[model samples]
Target: MQRYRMALALLGLAWAAGMAHAASEMPVPSALVGAWTLERVDNVYPDGRRVELYGPHPQGLWIIDAQGRYMMQMVRAQRSGFAAGDKSKGTPEEYRAASLDSNAHFGRISADDHTMHTHIEQASFPNWNGKDGNSAYTLKGDELSYVVAKPSSGASEGAHGEVVWRRLP
Candidate 1:
């Protein structure tokens, strides 16, 4: 009886160790886990015109964790300040400018060799909350690029947007 009890105990420890090892392995590939900064954000029209979606010299950060989660934010570098100096007191124009100048979202992410899938839990744009999206992506060395079929801002009706990022050291 005692021998059987010892065998069960040993089995439990081995099982626990296996679980811990699996947990330490990332759900996504190691190359995708890191801090990345925006390099460019542009919309390309069918007519071959390229528009800077976040304005020239846009600023942003994206962080992807080993657990298959990510958060991203981007903003126009030359956004106008609120004249009222208080968010609650902002005029309609100020509010509109604010809304059009930035994008932010947080969510879970998974990826295949060529596509990144996202499930946005929440976003600064309320319409995107609870949305699921997929985009084809390419990762080369420290750079990553992806396309959004229908971007939220700064695109003509039929235009698609490209976003590029550089992994941070």
Candidate 2:
């Protein structure tokens, strides 16, 4: 009786492992699976004025795998460097600049037609860690663009954020 119970437990464990592996293989949209380079980031106000969120020239990369996993990072092209040459020794201004100039996150993502859903497991901003977000997007040829309903950048009261990317070759 003891041997039969042990065999049944081992069989159940093997079945559970197989199910877990299958869950990670969830398919992602083909159009969104690739390496993409950031083209620009902007903030558009309610009045029709648009401002560059990350300076005139920004830099970033976003990579999405076929299995719905992704990582993304974006930064201003002209961010100021720390005067101390050591990150831990930066002053208050330096720390604030560093935090405001970059954004990064990674986790599972999925898309359906016009909206992309993100499950951020971790992010540069602690508030976004373990958060889920949905953003509307447009995919035209090699370019993909999305608009954030509410921006993290503390812009003007009614400003919305936009980010554009170009698919890599």
Against the reference, the lDDT scores of all candidates come to 0.88, 0.89
Residue-level lDDT tens digits of model 1 in 1-169: 9999999999999999999666433267778899999999998888888988778899999999988889999999898888878889998998988888899999988777688888899999998999988899999999999999988864456889999999999
lDDT of 2 by residue, 68-104 (tens): 9999999999988999999999999999989989999
Candidate 1 at residue 143, lDDT? 97
In terms of TM-score, how similar is model 2 to the real structure? 0.81
Q: Which stretches of candidate 1 lie above 4 Å from their native place? A: 1-26, 154-156
Q: RMSD in angstroms, all models?
A: 7.0, 5.6
lDDT of 2: 0.89
Provide backbone clash counts, one per model: 0, 0
What's the TM for model 1? 0.81
Query: Which lDDT value does model 1 have at 27?
Result: 67
RMSD of 1: 7.0
